[model samples]
Target: MSMFILVSGPFTDGRVWNEVVGRLRESGAEAHPVTLSSRPEADLETHIEDVVRLVDSLESPGELVLVGHDYAIHPVLGAADRRPERVGRIVHLDAGMPQDGDAALALVPDPSVHELLRAEGGPGPVPSPGPAQWQRWGSTEGLSVRQLELLSRLAAPQPPRTLTQPLRLAGTAASVPSSGILCTAGGMTVELVEALVRTGPPQFRKLADPRVGFFELATGHWPMVSCPDELAEVLLRAAAGEGRRLTVPEGESPFLGSFLFDTPERPRVRNGRLDLHMPKPDPGGAQGPRPAVLFVHGGPVPPHHEPAPRDSPLYLGYARYAASLGVVGAVVEHRLHGIADYAQSADDVAEAVELLRADPRVDARRIALWVFSGAGLLTADWIAAPPPWLRCLALSYPILAPLPGWGAVGSRFRPVDALRAGGGTLPPLVLTRAGLETPRIAATVEEFTAAAEETKALLEIIDVPHGCHGFEIHEPTDESREAVTRAVRTVLAHLEQPS
Candidate 1:
């Protein structure tokens, strides 16, 4: 009852995915490789319409899944935007991430490609690549001689408008489950670099989504040609809800955005049940103590909560991300709802900080707490006391006010109250709010922001337009990615500031 509607970009055809499709079908999954429009006048919208028509033609579309490569990443996303309910998920191959309001050329990491597009200003279908086209892309995707010949022969010039027309995201498209399959065999592309960036690119922004997953193949840009079997296996796993992996791990954090190839070093046991993800130090960088970030996850534990994994996905990637940027990152597995009050959660935070401070790899003087949603409750005491060892607090769509239905407890913990009772001088704080999140709980950001102002606390609130309560963990839009990067930078900036 699921289907992978494989979408190809310009310069290629449906045949490109033939091998992957075969492998997928062999695994008992329905797969279809869609050839994009080759007409000279076809624009971005037109391309998306074509794909939509194809999906509509299906007698019974069980669960539409879009698997896009290269430029197809945009059109397929647009199709999903136009038919969100029908489309269950999307998978972005090494192809660049779609940027709403930007052209394909704009997403390329190499600016020379942009220059080339501009110099060859278009009137109709873009010209096909010369015979040397394979010489250029083949090496990147690790194309074999036959693969190069076939791709070169099938390579058709795209409609100039297709590359130029800006992508239009209806917001709903980002809400769907998504995954990224990064190609690692070729020279680093923008998509690959963005994942490791301290502040990642718009395309990689959705990586923060808790629902989205990531994978990497030890092949070139065209994994279909270079590593079809491996690519197919990953696609199958992703479709089955197991796709997220740190393709080329580095100072990667738990997704909500992550770190580089070598990041997210193997998890080491810290205090009982606490897992630490440290970034392998940069070889060329100076040797010294690094800043630290303690990530606290949110959510109330169900009566019989099902544990996902021993390692924290969001925190692991985040820790690695921080490590990539020259810092030590750690994630704590605290009792989500073991106690009636917030004291236990606060104690867990304190324990994490104590452990980090004692670690030889950490700079005890500089550490920050990056809290997500419900975990903000634990920040109350720290916000009131302003611990000297803590540099700042970065909150993501936090639940600041005390809610009656949180759990049956003695008291409804209130962050605003704690800040108000503070000595008026709190640790510098940076908070992010998803603009599109539910009005009731989302209003917590404003409420706490106002309270922080009244208490003369140093606070900065970042509003991510079109982002929902858990935007980073599900899907990312330009707004959410930028918001996360900005908040992280704020925390780092605060830490870097001379005391």
Candidate 2:
């Protein structure tokens, strides 16, 4: 027999867990749903104390399971840190594993709410989201009309400080065994986490711990309200340390599985951080230095991710393909490792460009930079002032603007804004857009296209109507192959033009 302490996240009180609590108790286990303070003055510390008090009051002799949902995870972790001995297992129910100094506001998906929390000394209680806007927090699948109504009605305004205040952990709770309950409809799954871990990020490798278990709820983020019985059953199983253990596969990442072309390997000359694939000398000998195309791979890849992007098959294939075009092909390792590291990444790319220009085998006057994915932001500076040597700038399924949770990275990363600024003559810009792009990224692409038109920039669009993001590797259709070939030849044509 084990005792469960259920804690709810923002926009709700302990009552949110009533149905789940009842089901857990009916299974012959002790269960309690804690209601955090509703006062406007209540903060994270106050909420942590509320959970601590309940833990102290519990007289059950069974194992103690601390179940935290969404924002409540902060307080639950804090309480567990103070009383590690009392916490038998910590169950993350559709909640994030926030580290010390992480604020709940950062985990929130709604931009309006994010702005509200950033406003210091603003309003009292944070207003609850309406039913129509509930999707901003998490998917509402599996929820009935009555359940949605009850959820909206019972939703309470959370204290603003509860979100704004940074979480302070003593590191004691980490030793406690843990289990994760992923909500697939809310856009996370055990398989996805496994894939990410296989990508070789050291941070995610911690999930492969033998002591940590994993489970999935097909319902949305609010599983307690939408599927209480199922949530209760998972909780009972979690208390017994019974769930799937995540594994990091020994195979290469899926993103590196395939490439558009099946060209033969070329001789690669590696510098400190750059790999240059030298093309075969012109059959008719005695030609001028060959033009080069430098490929910039996308990411917010973990800085320490093993087998850096430059070494990946996707990038190596592109380099070899470029060499086959009778021009130098280059791949550089940039530091775009995290959301906040774009500035450093820009610097790294700039250094790589200088290295390329100084190479004796390359024609510095005829160069093209082809960027992909999140690295699209790095084009802002070049867009603002098109250099004489830059013959073309190409982007594929790029992020033209920052996403919501990126905070204010300033105009440095906003390529659309740079386009609208209207500076020097823009380079021939080539853009390949995926038809089934993520909504936020699609918005940025649309915005960039509009800006390109407004500024009358020399722009060209390649439409991958049947493709999704990362189509070059994942979607190996005739369309994908043609797009890759067209984009490459187009860039080569620009490079071949007489200076």
lDDT of 2 by residue, 325-378 (tens): 899999988977555567888888888999999999999999999998878888
Per-model TM against the reference? 0.48, 0.65
* Residue 87, model 1: Cα distance from true site in angstroms: 1.0
Q: Model 1: per-residue lDDT, tens digit, 1-499?
A: 5688998767788888989989999988889898888887788888899889988877644678789887899889889988888887898886655556656753433333444556744355555655456433323556667766777787887777887788998688778888777675544433434432322212334465666777878776778888889988999878876754334323232333322223435435466645565666568875677788888876543223333222534556566666666666677777654224356667777877888888877789998988886677777777767778788888987878643222222233578888877744677888887676554455666789899888778888898877655565444456666776787778888889776
Candidate 2 off by > 4 Å? 60-62, 120-124, 250-499
Task: Kindly report which residue stretches of model 1 are placed more than 4 angstroms away from their true locations once superposed.
Answer: 108-116, 119-124, 135-141, 187-205, 245-499
Instruction: Write down the worst ten-residue block by lDDT for model 2.
Output: 248-257
Best by TM-score: 2
Global lDDT scores for all candidate models: 0.68, 0.83
Clash pairs for candidate 2: none
